[model samples]
Target chain A: MTATAFQFDDVTFAYRTQRALEGVSLTIRSGERVALLGANGSGKSTLLRMMDALCFPASGTATAFAAPLTEAAFQDDATNYAFRRRVGLVFQNPDVQLFNPTVSDELAFGPLQLGWEKPKVRDAVDTVSARFGIAHLKDRPPHRLSGGEKKRVALASVLITEPDVLLLDEPTAALDPASRANLVGFLAREPGAGRTVVTATHDLDIVEDIADRAIVLAEGRVVADGPVLAVLHDVDLLRRTHLVFEHRHSHGGPPAGSHGHMHSSRQEG
Target chain B: MADQRYGICGCGRGRRGALDSLVLGLVNAEAYALDAEATATRPGFLQSVDPRIKVLALVALIVATTATRSLVVLAALFVAAVALALISRIGPGRLARQVWVGVLIFSGIIVLPAIFLVPGTPIVHLPVVGWAITLQGLRSAAFVVGRAETAATLALLIVLTTPWPHVLKALASLGVPAAAVAVLGMTYRYVFVLIEAARHMMEARRSRIVAPLDGRERRRMLMTAIGMLLAKTFALGSDVHAAMIARGYRGEVRLLHDFHTRPPDWVFLAIALAVPALILGLQP
Candidate 1:
């Protein structure tokens, strides 16, 4: 039986006066690749935060690996450490995530926090730096790096710990075309294999490559949940959720077979 | 569109607009960071030494420079500082801009009055005021100026040779509180982010200026920009805390301990300590 990695039951979260997530419930299995698709402010990031135990549900239950994800649950150091080791979250903004002074330190931060030995931390830093092609940037401060480099360092920092579940918030939001392709290609490759990957993004073009399952959110609610192709083919749901829209386009060769195609809401020409 | 002439209202001749200042500040910060990184990574004498020993030794030298009353020792120490900078690939022009010229001008102005005020053997008389320039005042001014320049040069060497993270780590290793070191490190890391945000804000403001902004309007605009920046900084801070927590920070900050002291580092430390001791011993 596949182990359930995360289970949310009617989870509702609010930020002071605004409702960020409402009655959002989903179950993600271990080793399954999933994409949380939504427009901006559609509760995608809030849900990922809850899963990572950074925040708690206001009125409902959320669990990771069958453990209750509450503030009190995380109060226990042992449980918190174990959970943090098992799950890693890469923030949407690389600047926020890359807070350490240097790329090497940032990569080693997680292992050190988890009480890994000094030698082990050093080895992990070296391995991950080389794997991410950031060995040249080990001594460089985070602020000195470019956007793509920062993003790579941020992801490599989290992946250094080899977490079982990886949570990425808008992993490709601000990347350039080549960088976006590089990141998407990397996500499609071996690092994500056998890890329960939950990526929250609004980009549709890379969804098929990064995820097998797609969970769509609209106005803080799960509007669609199915296989990747099924979700992509649901034009009505996609349009309603503001992920994509029907646009008229004609090929230069002929206008006889011209048909309206779905263009991503965030698509840039 | 408003007339370009009128658009330059508060930013007239001899006046610097806030937007220009913001852009200039950003550029200066970028240059400083690049220069520091370039110098720190260069293969040089001090750059090869361990950060902890370098920090301790330079600090000892600065303290010795301050405590010594001997003009000969102060001048020697200042010369030694310049020699170290030269060996460490720091050019004379860079040293002048980074330390010497500014310190000399500022300290000169401060000590100018002392030349007329201090009681000692009269050396020269001012043509207009007829105030005597005493020998004691000249000696006092040299001591003050030399101490300031030497101390600043030593401090700058530390900054220019070692990477900032290594320096902070060395501080932690030397019994500085981990929380304080962590705060300093985080501040250093995030200042660049804040500067970039501020630069973008200033650029957006500059792009939208179709009409002339008077002094009052410019002040209001500046105030509004500051308020917005504060709000954004608060939000960024909250998000950064969340990121930290997500990464298992768990309140007590932990950093990687990877510093190793070599035999050369020890030798450098010995020489650094010996020079200070020798200078102090030669005092009087």
Candidate 2:
């Protein structure tokens, strides 16, 4: 039996007056590839934050590896360090994640923070930079990198710690077509074996390639959770959540009158 | 015509406005940072030295330049600065544009009155104003300008050759608090982000302009834009902190300290120190 990586039971969270998540209950097993699908402001990011223990649920309970994710639980240095070593979260914005002065430093930050040895940190930084094909950019500042390079560096920085479970938010947003394709292909390869990867994104076109299970969110509530293909083929659920739009177009041939078709809003390149 | 005469309305004027100047200044600041990074990464004499030694040696030279009162010694230091720039692959034109011209003009205006106000042997006289240019005043003006120019050149050389983070780390090695160095690094990293944000706001406003804004309207628009930028900065700050925490930043920053000093680094440091010491020793 697979171990449970994350468990959220009746979790609800709010930001002052506005609620960001409501009654979100789900369980993700170790080694499972899952996608959190939602439109903007649908609480996918907030959920990822909760799972990473950066934020606590305002109600109910959230657990990671069967340990409760609470501020009090993290107060113990040993527990916090252990949790951080086993999980990594890559933020939606590369600027937010790549805060170090140089790419090499950024890649070494997590391990150094976890109290890794100096020599080990250096080796890990070099290995991760090379793995991501960012060896040439090791000394470059984050602001000087192009968008795709920044994304690669951000991912490398998180993966340097060799976390067991990786969480990514909008991983392919704002990428050029070729860069997007490159990223999708990489994620599809599942860089680490048996590594639980939960990605939060609204990009439906790449969903099938990145995940085996999909969870859809709307208005801070989970509307559906099922196999990736089943969830994707549910056109009504997709349209209701604003993940896809009704395409009305006419062809120039037989049966070419204008008709409404429901499909991925993203144009195939 | 009346509105134009009142300076509240105008057309067909191609002069740059305050908004344009602000945008240009922001863009130039970003470009200057990128240029410094490019120069720092170039294979040059100063770029190869360890940052800690480089910081100490350059600071010593600057101190030596400031302490010397003799014009000959100051001139020697200035000439040495030019030579160092040449060896470091920093072009003379870059020094002229980025340092020399601005320092000369601003410092010249400041010391101009000294040429006539000081009591000494008269060198020249202004016919209309009947003010005498004293020999002692000329010497004083030269001293002030020479010291300013030399010290600025040495400082600019440090900035042009060493990456900003390396400079901050070197400061940490020199007894600066780790928290202070971290703050400085974060501020340097985020300043470019804020500049880009401000440029976008200004570009958006410019796109909507149908006519020239009056002084009052321009002030109002600028104030509003500043407020929006401040709000965005605060939000970004919160998000960045959360991201930092997720990656296990536990209130203390730990960076990769990868600086290694070799034999050549030590040799270069000896030369850097000896030249400044030699200048000070030659001071009469």
Q: Poorest 10 consecutive residues of model 2 chain B by lDDT?
A: B1-10
Off by over 4 Å in 1: A250-259, B1-15, B279-284
What C-alpha lDDT, on a 0 to 100 scale, does residue A9 get in candidate 1?
A: 95
TM-score of chain B of each: 0.91, 0.88
lDDT of 2 by residue, B1-284 (tens): 32232232245574456655676676778789989988998998889989998888888888878888878778988898898899999989999999999999999999999999889999899999899999999999998899889999999999999999899878888778877888888888988888878777876786678876788888898888889988999998998998888888889877667689989888877877886687667766
Interface RMSD values for the candidates, listed in order? 0.8, 0.9
Interface RMSD of 1: 0.8
Q: Pairing residues by index, what is the TM-score of model 2?
A: 0.91
Poorest 10 consecutive residues by lDDT, candidate 1 chain A: A260-269
Candidate 1 colliding pairs, count: 0
Report the C-alpha displacement of residue B117, candidate 2, in angstroms.
Answer: 4.8
Provide the lowest-lDDT 10-residue window in model 1 chain B.
B1-10
Give model 2's docking category: medium
Predicted chain B of candidate 2, TM-score versus the true chain B: 0.88
